[model samples]
Target: MKKDRITTINKTAETIETDLLVYFAVEAKGKMPECDTAVHSQVKKAFELKDFSGKAAEQILFYPPARSKIAAARVLVLGTGPVNKEKDKGAALDMLREVGGEVAKVCASVKARDVVVCLPPPKHLSPALTDPEISAGALAEGIILGDYRFEKYKESTRKKTDYPGLDEIKFVCKDNLKIVHQGVEKAKNAAFAACTARDMANEPGNHWTSADFAAYAKQLAADTGLGYRCLEKKEMEQMGMGGILAVNQGSYVPARMVVLEYLPENRTETILLVGKGLTFDSGGISIKPSAGMEEMKYDMCGGAAVMCAMQAVALEKPDVGVVAIVPATDNMSGSRALHPGDIISHYNGVTSEVVNTDAEGRLILADALAWGIEHFKPACVLDAATLTGAVIIGLGHHYTGLVSNNNALAKAVEAAGSLAGEPVWRLPLNKNYEKQIESDVADIKNTGGKPAGTITAAAYLSKFVGKTPWAHLDIAGTAWEFTKKAYIPKGPSGTATRTFINLVRNWKPGKIK
Candidate 1:
């Protein structure tokens, strides 16, 4: 998919036959601007309509005159909602993407070859929020969000059915064309990396195990020329990674601690990213119910995000250095599985009482975090994990829960989230929650009380962070989606990959505001 930008809309613009996007907006009822008047009139007359007052997601096609010189066969009028509805900006942005995705789907069904998107003219934007900056932002987001398609596995089927695959998308923008193009390019690259990670994470457990995932990481590093190392169970045991060893006891496959490093030529500050890579979480001796156990394939989403983000960074080649640490293992149930009440020591030399074997994400993260703190000594560390169901209970799939010790780092990460289009909501990590993990038999219990479970989980990982500025992102709910919403397609959401890159790229030490 190639995206190009133009300065103005020319009705006589030479384009491909499948270029379907004819962008227009309703600033007021029955009023159309000069540039959009032709397209708007075509749509209105086709549907025998006076106005698009109450329509949403409505489609109107245009046919050029039999002897006309224009190239396009049809035009698509996307609903931008009413100009005076006090619109939800998020929803509006999402709608724009929805329009794109729907059009792509239509084109794919009909075997269309290419698309030309005539961007909504700046003058058609609502007066209340018509700033070019905001418009460009929304337009960029819409283009990327709309262009996404998860059809890798369906390519063969699609080909057999003669479905049209969109090969190119050209953007026709009047002003700020370069900025819009840059934003779209960045977003598309990030989205492509995320989609790769999401598909890998969504693969069945039998296909993506601890060892297999480590191999995949190594391949990514080799392909991108980033530093890569995988530590086996023996190596980890030598390093005293009891948390990972304990979790791997029941599985046939051994645990792996995979590390990928990206040190730019002009390195300055170091950022460490730790991800929980539970390839197939069967909950060990405390197994999860069979009802939704299939969803556990997504347990590795956090690790996948880290892996993909590292790949993106390597591709983008920012000045900062990045270290990606993923502790890969399968939490399974067997006679040899570690049971409840087992106490395991971590790399930090702190013991954890496994009250519930199902609470295993923190177990792997604990060892990874300790290793990161001890080895990398990073200026700031951010660990993303599908850590707690309690987060799902609190935020559903709308947002990832963020808990950080440094307010400055937290705000920076929040800003990163905004840029990545995966927003985070900061949750309290109060000392009261820390006490919940204080154990009678060990330094801390793996599971805290049911109340504030997510916060306590963050607190549990905090113990291993040492004094390094740290932030924990619990992405259990946000990592996978069963329904399509906004720019996110239904499946693995690739929640934090882009945000992680954005945060690291823009990070500044001792520059908290």
Candidate 2:
């Protein structure tokens, strides 16, 4: 992890000890913050020249003369657009995050190692968000996320600059020391969990295998006091998990089911998180096109998210009992690989006629969902998977496809996704779609048809959920992509880790009635 050392300081940026100083200046209205005469002169000169108006996404870079009173050499002023609306609250808060990411990109380009960020009190902003904690948290998220660079495969990271990427980031939040620390701590924990997920997702399929996932689960359990178990190929076969066995028959790496549980004393509700753990999806005998086949390593992002979410749950120690199940394997097209129209009898005796070998995520997920519900009897089940490209066609990259059986659970899932900056748009779960997956010789078909493909995929998983209030988050569109947008690099986004963590942390029982 190339993350910077994050700290909170009550002192102003001018007097802070760092290589660069960062400031927040609102668009068209922000007054220059109190600083030394030289810094003041620089700001005034920029305002006079009109070269650096405080517009949204705008930045002004200045270098103070040598031997100045301020300890910083370079100063970066970030622009925040007008933020006054109550309804656009999410957008406003996100602007702060955007500004933080912008500053981080600048610092990364310059290869600066340390910097001090000063959050100026914007007079035009609402008073409710004037609290130091909220702003500090948002900025920390951007700085940490933007500073990310998955350069592990690079031969050398050594550069000509004095330092590489950021090593330290000090946030000056004045007298609000306690709240600022609290916010920064929370952000740091969330970022740590999410970035860990990203790292796992970005790993090549060969490097991060089913056994590797089991190892990570054991480490997490050991570190966080969570109960962990790894059901190897023998155990899974003994338990009659046909879906997992069928998928792994093509791979030499073997299959494993990683189960992580965080139980608190006298917990009222249990929530099960099932993630599809296909480390690599080659579409089995029904092979995908050779193009873009390398990117199939991201097929395990769902498992990565669940693994990281369980880790976060352990750290937060939420009152609700949380159990995460990831049935991991690599789907390859060897001679013995599963062929089209194969019948897979899942853990719960639900047989699926696999029309397309590429639709393997739901097959593995069915086993975990069935086992998780029956063995744990969780109050609710939320299974996330990069299930289908139809979801990407429908929701694009901005939103995840959410389908659920119960209205109350659906509402809660949507709220959790929204709070975590991973919003989900609800799709219908009516019984009407169930018929699309009806099979001739099996209990159901792996895929329904071309029309409403996302809904039909959820319909197939719904069969194994039993009586639990279940929600399916098809994160196919949002998990990993090559697009470079703002703070998000061209790789895995750690899609649902924070949302799952938020759901567990804020979960309250008996409210669904």
Candidate 3:
């Protein structure tokens, strides 16, 4: 994974000599917002000719003539739409992130090695955008996220678009140098963690296995001063984690449970993050159709997001305790694959009848959630997984489906998601939904019928969480091919990485009751 070095300079965009100078502006009364007078006439002319409308995400590019006031050879303008005074800070940050993504995309297309981005002055911004530090961080995140490319396996000669990517990105701000630098640092750590998750999710199943996840977690712990431990098949079996053992019966590769912890000195509460690590889902005996089966390699995206988020947690050193548990395995339909009607007991002693092997994500997650909650005794628990296709039907790829037992915890997670540019929609968790997972032969079943499938899956996990303030995010839709945004690529959106980071970064002990 190659990342651009992001920096901030207390200087004007006109004075920066670079491959490109990018400016973001909002439309107002069909006139350009405050900009350098040197290029004011040129910009005004473009608006007059209707070459640029300055609509949201609209863009225009032109070269500066020799001896132009701006030092850059080329200039690009990106539109962020009309400002809304009623919009909150979250909306402002979201818009800036989109603008930042646009800047990176333009730079990459033109092979601009070094680029300078001019942050929109607060006076011309929405009322919510008054905070320069928050605005700068959001913009930086967009640049890092938009610049991601996963070409590790491509042959050097056969690779496409091999131009050296953005080598350096500089944010031009005239004042508040210290605050702006701090914002850039926050973006660098959180966004870099998100890219790390993208790289993991892009790897083919043959290259990345359950062991690879454990190995990565172990190394991340060593480098980041985190406490790490992993449970192999032997340990899981000893602990009677039947859900995991049952799922791994068909695969030669053993299952692993990777745990990483960040315990800050002034921690107020402990948050447990459980992620499903099904490396490749072949649907076991209830095998899925051959169509798009190759994409099952992304089944572990939830795990990638959780483990990689820990990297950001370590970097930021938030004043809260975080424990990440990923139960890793591959669900394959080998000769010994799990059979329908099989009853497996989880770590918490609750039994689940295996009705559909394709619904294996919940099985592994059940064990991890129960085990983590039992051992860690966290104040709150949040689990993310590509758990169900029903979530896609309900919310599509634009939002993550959230079901929670506690309102305060759910709202906290939703607020964090909103600020991170990952919107979460909460679905009603009714007692009626629990009836869908009830089993005649066991305590419960692995899946409910197709009706409200996403909710029932959450209902099943809810049994394991007991009274803990818990939230389950069905990220099946948003994990990949997420709504077409400039920063989010075609595959593996790295959906929950930043959401988890922000959840920890802004955590308040008194908020969760």
Candidate 4:
């Protein structure tokens, strides 16, 4: 872990000395001094030179000190593609990580002990498709993430080589260092929570069960000052939580409903956050093929993000009341497994016909959302879930799909996503999509066929919201990535946790105008 602080250009450069000065090259163009001197001809010519454009390849150029001139020990220039085409915040941030990782590799190759990254002035850069703060935050985040090394299990490898660890990092910025620092701390905290969630979610099913997750939630509440409660199987049955009970029938581990609340001082409005906690999704009696069953471990990422977001909120003490509800269980196949066409009564007294056991996320979320509405009476509600592959097919892994009834609430979430550097794209929630979830056999159906699967899932959960301004974030595609990009790692991205925290921290009632 490295500690970083931003210093201005007005500050003395002698305050810190390093082995290299890395500069960002936009469209193969390097920065040049403004002075008109004959000896500067070489530097000017170098700036005018162009390099071949590659898909995502980076080109590094080193400039050594000239005679009698003590230039930086070394100058490393990084290519960032054509400036106009690379202005997308997410893409630009990804480039920064690639560049940073290359720098780290070069430093290790030469055994250089220290390095400093010049955070360029924001004025020199064009506005990213996302907000400016997010771009800056993503840059900082990428540097940190690029330096991550999972060497804990390295002892088993026989290959021997020297890989120097990064000791410190210094960020160079002109203004808003405090605000940037705040964002940095928020990102770090969110990352830590995500790592914890990933570890829990990635554990083997035998090791991590619904009961185990419930106990961990209780422990988190005890360690922190957040309120916590766990509802047992009998309690859920007593409360008419048939959705959870049906999902848990096949698993030996009992279903547990965990609720954690953070009440802020002088709070004016409350927000409810519901997360789908399918600890392991076996597709139940509608068992999925074995090809991608390994990915089932990540099914609980939605619950993890919710838990992590609440943890971050408690740590930051945002000025808004929040209730995080997680319905923890596993969807497995056994003699007791739920069969298609089974009618289950939910907590809100709405009956759902189980059309497909694989569509279990919405089933559990229904109970959690109803619990939030009936208990917290929040002004607004937001739920995140790895609900559908249809979402991934629609939006890919780049953005989380957002569906909401209230335009204001949806926009707020989108803005929060921007500020947190976790982007979201809103999807429509038209009445035609809502009608897809309607059931002829029961009050509603758990699966709405294939068309608009993501929207139908949102609509199904919306039934339990009970007039509260609500939004649904389907993060099935973004919650986890197979490859590293920008600030996110190859595993759990901690997708919407920071966005939710930002939304609550900056929330103001009736401020939409």
Candidate 5:
């Protein structure tokens, strides 16, 4: 495991030795965040002189006076606009997350290797942000996430200098020491998982294939004591998972269904996770325009999220059982690539007619979803995939398109997403949308024409989940190039990875209620 970049300390801000001292300020008039009395007067003077206002994302960096008791060389104040509104806690918490990113960027700009952040007292903010544990988690998540850079393949001389060469970050929290440490650990685990997903997503198609996914999962299982297995192409063939094999027909690399399981002692219930792992999508024989096909390397972000989420679950040791399956393959335009009007059978024997080869994500996901449900008999099933471009058109990259067969499961997932700052908007899933996928030649068609494309894709996946409560996150829009936030980088947001971690950590048996 990589060394942790953040930790918590019981020391006060005024006594801690660090290159930078960080504080978050809110917009309330004459109200300031918890800080040293000397530093408070300085910030108060700045506010009086109109040098700073606590509007969201605002920051003021100044060196502490030589006479002041503050031990840090410099102090940075970040603005979080009016967090008192009780109506939107999710947005309020995200303000802290955004500020965390801002601090990381500042650390990089000034080359501050050691930093200490002073978390605001519970009395000065909204109920949601007032909880020290939740706020600490959000801040920790922001710092690591915003500081991430995928320069693995770049030469050292050409690498970006803006990368945060952070050595350590200590959180100054007024809450109980043990509680704050738990919060920091939670955030550390979640952020690391998200970054792992980002690393996989940023890998070039040729570098990250179905075999790479299997290898990564296999090693992760060995290191974390999780059960691991990968079904090779021949194994998939014998099992008659035609959907996955059909999608892999074009690639030189063989397909694999990578599975990781965490069955804790006295497990209450089981949840199955499925991700679409298209290592690359060239639209197969149908072919996509060359304009932006390079981004096709991100087509497997769903698989990255699921595989990395298991890393968090393993470390946290959540009591609930988790079973994750990723069907890995690349869709290329080889001579043997899948063609339009091709018919394939899924693991459950459901036949699908391929109307468009570009819609191959659903093809591979169908087999994994069916196989996971049949074998694990999980209480609920959730799947995430960058499955449709229509989702981009519908949600416009700000929201993940959620389609679920059960309302109870959908609400739970939505709440978890909100807390994770990877918000998901639930879309309708009924016979009205299901009818669009109905096919005359086969049980269902892969594409439901152009209208309601995202829904139709979910509708296609719905067939394989059977009656088990299921939710599908169409992260097509949110997986990468997500809404501009200081914490979310330009490529591969690692969106649903945190949401999955939060969901699994907070799982309660019979949570459908």
Candidate 6:
């Protein structure tokens, strides 16, 4: 993907020099928001002609000749429809993201290298972000997110854009200049981190192994000044992380448990983020069907999200203490590969029966969670994984499946998901489902059959979190290949990265604050 230039400026559309100048038009109750008089006269003329309607995602490109008195060669007008009418603040924000995405695609179609975006007039904005700074920030996030692309492998064959990346993205906002600038910076950083996660997920498994995860984490640690460590097979054996080791027995490469830590200057409360890092899950000894096994490369999406999020947290330098753990390895069918019915003890000393090797995500996460709690003693533990197909069955392609031990933590996660435009649904963790994972021989069984599969998997990981407030995000549906949206590509949605980052940035460290 091309790296773009994003700038927040206190300049007008006609004042900026660019290949294309874009303006936002807000329509409510069939009326358009106030526009710059210079552009307004033209837009009014178009509306009167019935040639252009100010509807959401609507656009029109105009070639204002040299005598047009416009600094830009072309001008584009985008419509954000009736956003002010939405009763729910959450829904309004989501619509704004989509609007931003549409604007980016419009620029792409026109081959606009240097672009300018004017913030919507205050009269048309939703009350949720009444502050101009907040509103401008949301729009900035949309523009950057909309510019995302993943064609690294095909770079040699792909046609180039007019510019390698966006020549300039200048935002013209009239109020709270400093806050708007800050918002743009934050959004750019977050979007860059999310795109990084997408790049990791989009790579083929052969290129992105446990070793690759370690190198990436170490490089991030070195660049950001975070503490990084990779515990190899011998160290894991000594530490007794049987769950991670058992699943890796079938692969040619050794297992690694990667740990990254960020210690902020302010007085601290520890927060642990654990991710399942199965690089390519071939389902091991049990094996998966021949069809669509190619998509297994995305098995490590949870780990990718955590790694990139840590990069962002390090750059943002949040006030709370944060730790990230990724237990990385591939699940394959080798002579030494683990078999169903095999028993393995976890880092927390809980022995589990491996009923199905494909259910390996929870196993690696179990070890990381147990180890993280022991070493970090974090106040809150949050882990995400593409764990079960049942989540897609339960929530379909729209939401992540959430299971939490604490009400406050659950509520916080849900709120964060809402703000990030990645929504989630809470699942019941009643003790009745716990019985599904109960084992006759071992302390617990890995597979709970098909019933409540997502919940039972969360229950299995719940055993290792101890008493710390914990939440599990099952992103089986949102991670990839569900459907294509205007902004997000069809593969590797980078599903929970933003929500996790939002939680860390807004968190109080104690009480899930």
lDDT of each: 0.75, 0.81, 0.88, 0.72, 0.87, 0.83
lDDT of 6 at 351: 94
CA deviation > 4 Å runs, candidate 1: 1-14, 27-38, 43-48, 51-56, 82-99, 105-111, 122-159, 162-165, 174-177, 482-486
CA lDDT for candidate 5: 0.87
Ranking by lDDT: 3, 5, 6, 2, 1, 4
Error of 2 at 353 (Å): 1.0
What is the C-alpha lDDT profile of model 3 across 190-239, one tens digit per residue? 88999999999999998889999999998999898999999999999999
For candidate 1, list the clashing residue pairs, or say none: 7-174, 19-116, 108-164, 111-164
In candidate 1, how many Å is residue 335 off? 2.8
RMSD of 6: 1.8
Ten-residue stretch with the least lDDT total in model 4: 33-42
Q: Candidate 5 at 418: error in angstroms?
A: 0.6
Worst 10 contiguous positions by lDDT, candidate 5: 30-39
Candidate 1's error at 55, in angstroms? 5.9
The per-residue C-alpha lDDT of model 5 at residue 353 equals: 93
Point to the candidate with the largest lDDT: 3
RMSD of 4: 4.6
State model 4's lDDT.
0.72
- Residue-level lDDT tens digits of model 1 in 1-513: 543432223334434464565555453455532235546556555434554432445555556765655577766665554553435443444444455565565555445566666666554544433544445545554445444555655554575555434566666665666666665566555666676777778688998888877888889888999999999988998999999899999988889999999977677778899989999899988889999999998999999988889877887787778999999998998778999999999998999999999999999999999988889878888999999999889998878899999998898888787656577899998779999999999999998879999999999999998778899999998898723654566778788987897776676655542
Worst 10 residues of 6 by lDDT: 159-168
lDDT of 1 at 202: 66
